[model samples]
Target: MEKKKLNHYDVAEVIDRFEINKVFDCFTLKNWLAIGTTNKLKPSHSEVLEEARQQLSIKWDEWNEEELKMNFVSMVIFVSQLDVPKHINTYFERKLSGKVNEISISVTVDCMLASPTYSGRPKNPYFFLQEFKRSLGDNHDPEGQMLAAMILSQKLNEDNEPLYGSWIQGRFWYFTTLTNKDYCVSKPFDATEPEDLLQIVYVLRKLKELILARVTP
Candidate 1:
């Protein structure tokens, strides 16, 4: 008999399997703002963002998924300073067991941020970011992807603290948090706006701080 491999599912199918609902009433952007951004955006970062924003407005429809990742997503990583040295990119398959079922969940995230290990290997991801290729369509499900990634990350987290993740579709970004099996998603923030992008940078900076606090003595 052949051995059965772990099942594979896209972000949307996973969301349906888990019965994840869009309970906007449980989401809060005001409390998220209190986390604050101590790492202020530099003038250079602002210029790059403005250029990318303008280009995206015109060319987004023509761009592919990798184009979106490279042009928009990579820029956010750069502006937020979430590169390999500080947080390794183990954007490969992350496998986790499900809580409610006898099944496994996995995803190859667009980006996975985690603390650096001396062994030079990718450690448990604390945060994830996924880019949903189609932005204009109402059917886009970046939130599902975000929540799925967060759920897996939450299981991988040994610290047992809240696991966070975000997803972007076109110029819009949304955030999610998984704490004690309770998931909450935040209202969307447009990356095309300078102020909104700055908040993203700050939130990323805060994430770095949180990682350091957990991993460092």
Candidate 2:
């Protein structure tokens, strides 16, 4: 007897033949994507994300000082979301007894990679700072770092006006870290390569599909 050759159709048939409706749900799809990204299946961009997830799971509770430093870079990248700026502003306004409009967020760290001197350089960038801490330790102080970064990033004018500059414009942060054994990677706000952006898009699209499915039927 000879082994049968399998094609795309054969694979599709296998999936289609299964009662997928029973298992398909938002949680399932999200987990599937997470697994796929973690396992580095087929698609290549998910490799880093998967590695980050594995690192998070293993080091989440250990809280070893060495691991904290090693994991910090990935955590920084992982938690750096678009909504960070708004949250920082809200918190500061309440804490300082100032209006929301009075607060401004800036990204400091004056490295060449973080320099605002050049166009397209990672200027004032915002990040989900609290999430970065949570990635390190459960007892990590969120209010400390998040508030510090926000307060430090703001500008003060002679007349007490918020003078924001595009060079120092948006709420963004910069991070550089070592991964695996020898490689060091640095990403600035808006500094990600096109491929990483595409991976984010792919994950977001999958998430949207899962969400839409929940609303239908």
Cα-based lDDT for every prediction:
0.65, 0.29
TM-score, per-candidate, Cα-based: 0.76, 0.30
Residue pairs with clashing backbones, model 2: 38-50, 124-172, 125-171, 125-172, 125-173, 126-171, 126-172
| Residue range 1-217, candidate 2, lDDT tens digits | 5433212212122223321121222332234234244412334435654555456446555544335435533333333221222111111111211112333222222111111223332333222223222232333333223333333333211122111111110112222111111111123333133344334334433433433333235
Clashing pairs in 1: none
- Using TM-score as the measure, which candidate wins? 1
- In terms of lDDT, model 2 sits at 0.29
Q: For this target, which candidate reaches the highest lDDT against the unseen true structure? A: 1
Off by over 4 Å in 1: 1-32, 35-39, 83-100, 136-140
